[model samples]
Target chain A: MHELSLITAMMDLILKDAQSRGIRKITRVELKVGEFSGAYPHALREAFAVASRATPMEEAELVIEEVPAELRCRECGAVFRPSETGWACPSCRSQNVLLQGGLELEIQSYHGRDGDVGQGRSRQGYSSGEQEES
Target chain B: MSVKVVVGKDILAVNRKRAEDLRARFKQMGIKVVNMLSSPGAGKTSILEATIPRLQKVRAAVIEGDVATTRDAERLSHLGIPLVQITTLGACHLDASMVWKALEEMDLSRVDLLFIENVGNLVCPASFDLGENLRVVVLSVAEGTDKPAKYPAAFLSSQVVLINKMDLVPYTDFDLERVLGEVRAMKPDMKTFTMSCRTGEGIDRWAEWLEKWVRESQ
Candidate 1:
């Protein structure tokens, strides 16, 4: 899927930002993807795992928050999320509406920790098997 | 302690910037690029095969993007036109960088109309812009009539929607009018064309539209 490409772009930006802040390794990445953005969360998760290998972002927890697709009625200017029937605005029931904010793909934030030479191999003692909680 | 940095940047920002640069270059060179998206077996390549010859007035070039095959490039190369092919290896869609590289391989001095045939994907390709002047999504009648409803993003982003394989419409249970109505609802001012590559029914109309844009761009 193109999620590989999407994740690649995200990782590039994240790594750049992380590097600028002197982050040697990343612990987690929080991303908000809109439903209408055409990036499925499930597929993106799988892509993230494969794409982050052998990098400073290896084994990082990827927290994805999905944004619901919203629409603005062209005829009535009423903004609402589409129901089961379709993308028709709930207020005016107009099918001819513009999508407002369902197509978002952005990184809200990320957590990174500096590499410690003193910790060395001891860092793998306990937390190696456990995920560091926020 | 781990630092949690609040970085609110669009993941596609890099691609968008590159796309804007390509757009400026195209504008400077007076080149018109059309990005075509479609699902597999939707007659995109066939439509291109049909339409290219008809637009004799404009010097048209094609950039074919496929997941893993040079067959599309080979097919278009037979026309003796300047065609560059980008194989994404396994990627689902083509991005601005890919098109920018493809453009480097071609001589744009005499080229006025450039067609970027995107990978056969209705979903991911809609999100990536190849810096085309116009975006057209092709749908074949055999694919079913509710396609526009199922894939709203493609219709929303496209300025033109082409319904291909019209010759097979009578055989399939495709409701042409209903499909058109749904397409209109998504994009009221979208330019639409109904054509069949096999029958050559409306190729001239499409070619004429391309000619008009090519001239206007110049």
Candidate 2:
């Protein structure tokens, strides 16, 4: 239900960065959403569809990568995926556990059209884009 | 003509930064903040009403969050403590910015314990950080025992869990052991307190623990 607010916050960040970099239109957005991040992927997709309207991302494709929940047992030094019914360590049956993963809610990257470089130039031979990891 | 921009930024980075700033400010002022979360009608207000008076050595303040109501703020007004009411108007949760705005309205010069009663929803609030020293989840017996299993995010994120409404347990099918077991399975070291605000049971223990934390923060 708070997906709309989350989408708005995410759009604020992405659009600001995109605008500063002279990105005229975003084509794809990749987000890493954890299973336990307290946000539903389907809901986020719906929110994105609504929030991205009339913006640079109006026709963008929203890509979500879901991360599974992981727990590490303190006593047994074991790492495992927690069962739906319990979070105890499978190796030692210890309840002392720490959530090692699956709380991520991050925007990994986006594909955007370069506004400065593509000003009515020849559109041929520019299908593949260069990769930049920050 | 297309380029990939690698952001790798957290979605809630703005809220997280605000919460961190508030945390630093609270630490400088020697204030221990307790953020309370629970479902609707889970005795959050009643627990506050019962526990506030028992904080004999601590000067407490409250920030009440609701979708749209001043009643909770009014309930604690007779306690004579500095209180601020934040009506979200329709928001399901209170983020850090809202809390920062609320803090501007209060004077925390002599306050030792600050309680922020978040809006009544277990899901969205768990994702928000309000710069509180402790996160307390109040689960009443009337809410049923499967709450921990159903709402693992809240139970896992909270450091303390208060099982309220002990008096109503006999009438309901609330299994105390099952709830505690599930809670422990998620967080083994979660500090839990079973109390009844109506009957005044276990209030002293809860209040003393809170006062101790507040005094230790100072």
Candidate 3:
């Protein structure tokens, strides 16, 4: 599955960052996968288990947070979760809608042990923008 | 001791950056790039073979992606156009980096339109952006009408949907209205084209629209 490729890419990113921060071994990884990101959490875990072997994340715990898909109506400026059968705005019944969320596929953070002091440390990768809903 | 790192980074950040760079290059060269996606045997190559010749005024090039084999590449070799083929070996989809590498093998200076035929898959390709101006998902009548509902990622991300192999519609249980209805419910603004590559039906309108789009991008 393509989830393997995604997991490999994610591991590369995490390992590179971990190495730079003097992390000897990764203990945990947290990911935010959106409903529309085309990646399933179960598949991701299976991929992670396969991709992390012999790497710093060999024994790491993989945590995934799924985000629900949200749509914003352009005509009515209303934000709501799309119905299973349609994406039309519930408020004004407009078909002019934009996806407001549920397309995210990102690494939120990681837990590791520093090589020198053997102390656990946490690093913030980047700031995510506020997702506003109406 | 366990430490936490805040890595609020998009998983495909590297690929996205490369795609953005490719987009800038395409824009600079005034090339309209169209990325085509579909499942196996969905007539992507057939449609291209029939439509490219009708492009008429537009100068076109193609970068074909396949899991293995260059058969698709050979099919279009008769067009006498610049073509490059990327055989991914085992990768299920083409990332922007692969496309970036393929571009280095071709000359796009005189190309008005560039068609990137992605690996025949509806899933993984939807998640990877190749910096194309338009994304088209090709569905054949044999694939059934429920494809849009089953593979929403591909349908949702695509701007255009081409329902190919209309000649075989009577032989299959494909419901055109149902498929269009589902697509409309998901994406109301999506442009749709129904065509039979064998009979050359509906090819002219698609080719004309494509040519106009290419010219407008220039």
Best by TM-score: 2
Ranking by lDDT: 2, 3, 1
Please provide, for model 3 over B1-218, each residue's C-alpha lDDT reduced to its tens digit, 9 standing for 90 to 100: 55677778999988888899999999988888999999999999999999999988899999999999999999999999999999999898999999999998999888899999999999899989899999999999998888886787899889999999999998988899988987887788899999999999999999998888788767
Reference-based lDDT, residue A27, model 2 = 92
**Which structure is stronger by lDDT: 2 or 3?**
2
Candidate 1 displacement at residue A47 in angstroms: 1.3
TM-score of each: 0.90, 0.91, 0.89
Mark the regions of model 2 whose C-alpha exceeds 4 Å error after superposition. A75-79, A117-134
- What fraction of the true interface contacts does model 3 reproduce? 0.59
Error of 2 at A26 (Å): 1.4
For model 1, residues A51-86, the per-residue Cα lDDT tens digits are 999999997999999998877888999988755445
Q: List the residue pairs that clash in candidate 2.
A: none
The CAPRI class of candidate 1 is acceptable
Model 2: per-residue lDDT, tens digit, A1-134?
A: 78888888889987877776667889999999888888999999999999999999999999999998889999989999978667778899888888878888898888888555344342233332234522
Alpha-carbon DockQ of candidate 2? 0.44
Q: How many backbone clashes are present in model 2? A: 0
Docking class of 2: acceptable
lDDT of 2: 0.88
> Per-residue error at A41 for model 3, in Å?
2.0
**Which digits, one per residue and each the tens of the lDDT, describe model 3 over residues A1-134?**
68998898899888887786677898889899988888999999999998899998999999999998988988989999967656778999887788778888999988777444233342233244211111
Which has the higher TM-score value, candidate number 2 or candidate number 3? 2
